[model samples]
Target: MTDLTTAFERVELPLETPFTISRGTQHTAANVVVRIEDGEHVGVGAAAPSRHYGETAATVEAVLPELLDVVEEAGDPLALDRIDARIDGRIGDNPAAKAAVRIACCDLAAKRLDVPLYRLFGLDGERTVTSSFTVGIDDPERMGEKTRTAVDAGYTVLKTKLGTDDDEARLAAVREAAPDARIRVDANEAWTPREAVDNCEWLASYDVEFCEQPVPAEDPDGLRYVYERSAVPIAADESCVTLADLPRIADACDVANVKLMKCGGPRQAVEMFHAARAHGLETMLGCMIETNAAIAAAAHLAPLLDYADLDGSLLLDSDPYEGVPMPTGLVDCSALDRPGTGARRA
Candidate 1:
C-alpha cells in the first residue's frame, strides 16, 4: 500500500476592488489549498471559507489535519462514494474541509486514470456555458465603471451586488454601462419579503435576469412570500447549503446556487444537481472567492447547469495558480483535458 498524506496552505488573494454585500466588505480572500500525495500521484483542491456558513481559514486549517488518516485508510481515489462516506463518518459539519479532501481525491484519481475529471462522470466539456462576472457593491459611478470594463473585456453576463439604499442607483449605473449584457443581482439576503418583491418589480423594468437571496437565508416564509410576488425570478444562494436544505427551499426559490465549498465537493455537488432537478428547481454552479483549483473542478461540471458564477479567480489581482481556461465570462474547458482537475501551482 502506498503511504498517503495530506497537506494545506493558506493564501490571501487580493481582490482588484473591494467586495461588499449585506454582510460586510472584503478586500482580500483568505483561501486554503489542500494537497493529497501517495508518493506516486498527487491531487489538489482549494476553497475560500465564508463566515456566512460558519467556517473560516483557521477552522479549515484546523480540521484538515484529521483527513490524512481517513484518506490513507480509504485507499482508492476513484472510490468516490466510499471516500465521501469515510470522511463524513470521521468528520462532522466541516463542509469546506471535506470539500478540499474530496476534490484532491478526485484529482488524484483522474490523474491516475490519465483522464479529465469530467470523464469519470461521463460528462462533456465541449458544451460550455457563459459565466457571470460579479461587480461588487460600491458607489454607483464606480460600479458603472467596473461594469463597463467587464463588458469591454467580453463578458456577456454580469452579476451585480445589491443590498443597500444605493441599489436603485447602482442598478441604473450598471444598466447604463451595459445595456445589452445579461444582468443578474445578488442582494446577499438583506431584504424583507415586501422589500424584495417591491425591489424585484422595480428590477423587472431593467430586464434583470434574476434576484439571488433577496431576503435573509433563515426566513423561508419570507423567501416564499417574495417568490410568490416578485416579478423577477429568485435564485437562492445562502438559502441552499446542502442536499437536505434543497427540498426545504425548493418552493421558496426558482434556482439553487451550489458551491463545492458549501456542499462537500464534486461528489456532493452532483447530488445537489440531481436533487435540484428532482425538485424542478433550476441549478447554478457558483463558487466562493477561490483560485483555479475549485474553479477548475467546478468548470468540468459547467455544461450540466442552468447558470454559472465561477469568476472567483478572474476577480483576483494576481492568481498564484493555473488550471482551467477562463477568457472573461467564457469557460474554454479544453484546458481541462489534462489529468485530474488541472490546477497547478504557478
Candidate 2:
C-alpha cells in the first residue's frame, strides 16, 4: 500500500463565445477538477460533465468524494485497474466523475514512473493526428467569421456544428471562410435518417471529411439507414459510449467518436480505440468544453486516433491549467517536455 491524498473542486469556466450545439447554448462550462498527491507528485484531472450524458457539475461534485475515497483507500495510484474496478463497483454511472479519478491516477502513475503519459502507454510521439477546431452553432455570418478566425489562427482542420434549420447556408458560409481547411460536421442527433442521407450528399459536395451522429442514439436502425446511404462517412458519437457499444455500432457507422467523460478515462479510452479498430471502425476522440487538466490526458491518446475534436480547452476564455500543446490544431506530443500528462497550473 502507498500513501495517497485526494481532493476536488468545481470551477465555472466562461466560454470564449457562447457555445451552441443542436440541443442548446452554453455560456459557461462547469468543470470539477480532481487532484491526487503522493507526497512529492500531484496529479491533476478535470471533469467537463455533460447533461446530454446525464451529468452536470453538481453530479460530478456529489460523487467525487466517494470516488476519491476509493482512490485513497486503494492507496496506490499505479494500481489503476484495481482502483477503476472499485470505482465502477461503487458507482453505477457518473462516467465523468470516474474519468476524473482515472485521469488523476494515470497522471500519478506516469509521473511516479518518471515518464510522459504517452511514453507510459508506449505511443510514439512522432505518430500523431491534428485536432479539429470546432465552430459551434451560430448565425451563418458569425459561423463564417469563426471559421475565418480559426483559419487565421493556423488551424488546418475544422468541425462545424449543424442541426440548424439553415444548415446549408451555415455550411456554405464556413466553406467560403475556410475553403482549403479539412472540414467535418456534427448534427448531434438532430436529423431523421432521410434528412441525414440528404445532408450527407451536400456535406460531401462541400468536401466535409465526415458527418457525426446525424440521428438520435436510441435509433440504431435509423443510424444504419443513414450510414448505408450517406454519401459522406458517418461517425457515431452519442451511439458509441462504452466498449460494449463497438459491436452494436460497427456496421452502422464508419467512425467511432469516443470521449473520456463518456468512456471513463484514458485506460478505458485505449480499450475502446482498439476495440473500435477490431470492429473495422475509424477511431476519433471528442470532448466537451473542458480545461487543459482534462483535455491534456486525452491528447496523449492522439497516436491512436484517426480524427480528433479536442478543441475543448481552446474554447475556454481562460484556463488555470495547461496541458499538451496543440499547435495549429496538431496534437503535438513532441512538445510535451514534462512528466505525467503535462497538465500543470498555469
TM-score of 1: 0.97
Model 1 lDDT on a 0 to 1 scale: 0.88
TM-score, every prediction: 0.97, 0.99
lDDT of every model, 2 decimals: 0.88, 0.94
Candidate 2 lDDT over residue span 171-221, tens digit each: 999999999999999999999999999999889999999999999999999
Best candidate, TM-score-wise?
2
lDDT of 1 by residue, 1-346 (tens): 4577778899989987788877899889998998888778889988688888889999989888887578887767777787788788888998888888888889998888898888876778787888999999889999999999999999999999999986899999999999999999999988888889989988999999999999888899999999988899999998899999998998988999999999989979998999999999999999988888777888888767999999988888878888788787777666655778888877
Deviation in Å, model 2, residue 26 alpha carbon:
0.5
Output the lDDT of residue 314, model 1: 86
Instruction: Give candidates' CA RMSD values in order.
Output: 1.1, 0.7
